[model samples]
Target: MNNFKFSENIESYLVSAKDIFISKIASGIKTRDELFTSLYNTLLLPGYFGFNWDALFDCLRDFHWIDEYLVIIVHEDLPTLSEEELRIYLHLLADACLDWKIDEEHKLEIVFPESVRCKVEHLLSAD
Candidate 1:
């Protein structure tokens, strides 16, 4: 499992030779519903998706439908959710990363732009 943050040179990170599945969450996601919808569409989640945090974690940890060994989720911008929801989202990401590490079948990487890196780190570190 690799670190979540990409180096300052994202171009180099994007130059991987291995097969990878990349999903981009476009900006302007202000609500949990929008975030779920974007993830559902971008990741091509199964119809059984419940559109909730648990469902997201389940689907993210079980990317059996995706053939690529490396899965990269790039967030164009952070969502405008309540503190609790944001904390849950970040924990979900960290949990999924840990789950993938144990599974050893796929690698999950979450990338945030440099502009919001500090904010993201702060949120993740908050108790």
Candidate 2:
């Protein structure tokens, strides 16, 4: 995805996302909580990360500590998130990513299963 530039304003966020996926979080995760913990530990956010959806959003947007963009790689064995749950999680991530653009300092990306990649991408793109 090196040459995959986003819209006029998105910039090169995907490059950092791809690097993070290859180096840090390219594992087989099963649950949303697992994903959250893995990302939290990878990014080394705060010791008191809430490890919940709301907390995740807060930590992602509150990246005053780590100024790098955040890219989440969701490999196989991901938990069976319901449609509603999936939408909520993706929405939060998408929101965090967009908010990062305010300072052009951080961003978020998610690579889901091929089965749901299109669906998830559609959801994020729709935002």
Candidate 3:
């Protein structure tokens, strides 16, 4: 949902990650594994935000598809959410991702609002 107007190249880059994600799911991969694998792989890569956000924006941005992964990170980083809340957040994120839509009604749950939600939701649902 980043309103910052990322370049089309950025969107295309994100789409690449999204393609991998869909393939993973279609192949019966676990959600956590898919997300973390993508994020961790991207984070370990070279550039800003630990790696260029545009180049891996699907896994990095504030979309429903990635909130569970961020929620897991939040437990490690925020030190506030209880084990149950973290679990709940993960479920919420999963539900949101499964039913994503570009319309105004689908408000993505942002545990931490670093980027836009709706725009990312749009990209996620576009597939």
Candidate 4:
């Protein structure tokens, strides 16, 4: 589908959120550290960012400071993370999004290239 992909939770988020901010990362990003750095800078995260998945979840948990109801993170490259790492990353992001949607009425979305899209969808479907 040319339209944005939505699993059950994401669809709910879009239905309720008002404002949206789309953050895009062009190609060539590789490595977990680079992925974190790119996302941190793009999102204008708090200065306390710890550059780990836990820190990422923490930062995303309270992103109202960015002043938007929804955040869509779009990436054009695959990180150097292993398959397991990538799966965990996607789960963490999805969990954070769902948590925010339930508690703060905020939403988060992560979009990658179609190649990664299939992997992401598969990962999410597993849960």
Candidate 5:
């Protein structure tokens, strides 16, 4: 999501899709896997937050573990998004982990693998 300067059409779609995922996470209407499904569905767009959430979840599920996250960040909007917005996006992901009762320490071990995790970390850290 770092290169969010996408075509207006792609950005527009993600703008709406972010809202959908945000609302679902907020209202307890969606689970971690459901959120990933919605995200994967929208990933056809270039500059979209394309992730291996499905593959990761499949691996975790075999161990009876689950993971959840949101690919959007306030930072994705660049100068348009405030630090507050970035925190909000991150906060939502944290809340989902809490809601699902994921143990923090284990989650650290389970989320994204090193190479992919570093990229995602850089994306989220973008100001």
Candidate 6:
């Protein structure tokens, strides 16, 4: 299964999945609080969610409550966070993508718009 990808045509990704859960994170998420709230509401994270980086990573990796075969997180735009926060967030996502790789029955995919493809790649590579 694909991990993280950048594409303008999100529909292409949706068309092939038999069972899919799509969560779109709207634009203008400028702070960690906004990001977490958006994730909690959009992904329907469990009540045990702890509103922190570690908690976000845990929720992203463990989606047992979701029944869909494919889970896709579509980021409309990058959050305007502090450099350190953004780095941590990106790495957490990369690590979660790696963890989800071993799940044969489930897939976690993150898609960013093509406009920010270069920025995302640069941020990820800076790690």
Clashes of each: 0, 1, 4, 1, 0, 0
C-alpha lDDT (0 to 100) for residue 83 of candidate 6: 81
Per-residue lDDT for 1-127 in model 4, tens only? Answer: 2223433333333233447766665566667787788888888988889999999999877876677777777665556677777777777877776665445656676666656667677876775
Question: What stretches of model 1 exceed 4 Å from their correct place?
Answer: 6-18
Error (Å) of candidate 1 at residue 17 is 5.6
Model 6, global lDDT: 0.83
Clash number for candidate 2: 1
Q: Candidate 1 deviates by what RMSD? A: 2.4
Per-prediction TM-score to the true structure, in the order listed: 0.87, 0.60, 0.22, 0.74, 0.24, 0.88
Q: Return the lDDT, model 1, position 99.
A: 71
Model 5 C-alpha lDDT per residue in residues 92-113, reported as the tens digit of each score: 4444344433443222111222
Best by lDDT: 6
Candidate 5 CA-lDDT value = 0.33
Model 5's number of clashes is 0
The reply for model 4, stretches above 4 Å from the true place, is 1-18, 102-105, 124-127
Candidate 1: worst 10 consecutive residues by lDDT?
Answer: 6-15
In model 6, where do residues sit more than 4 Å from their true spots? 10-17
Query: How well does candidate 6 score on lDDT at residue 76?
Result: 79
CA lDDT, candidate 2, residue 98:
62
For candidate 6, the TM-score is 0.88
Q: Which pairs in model 2 have colliding backbones?
A: 30-79
Whole-structure CA lDDT of model 1:
0.82
- Please provide, for model 2 over 1-127, each residue's C-alpha lDDT reduced to its tens digit, 9 standing for 90 to 100: 2211223322222345432532144345556777777778766779888888888889866766664454453333234566666677777766675665645655555444445556666655664
- Indicate the worst ten consecutive residues by lDDT in candidate 4: 1-10
Whose TM-score is greatest here? Answer: 6
Where is the poorest 10-residue window by lDDT in model 2?
2-11
1-127: candidate 3 lDDT, tens digit per residue: 2212223222332333322331111122234444444445433423333332233334333433332222221111111334444344344444544444555323332232224335334433543
Query: What local lDDT does model 5 show for residue 74?
Result: 20
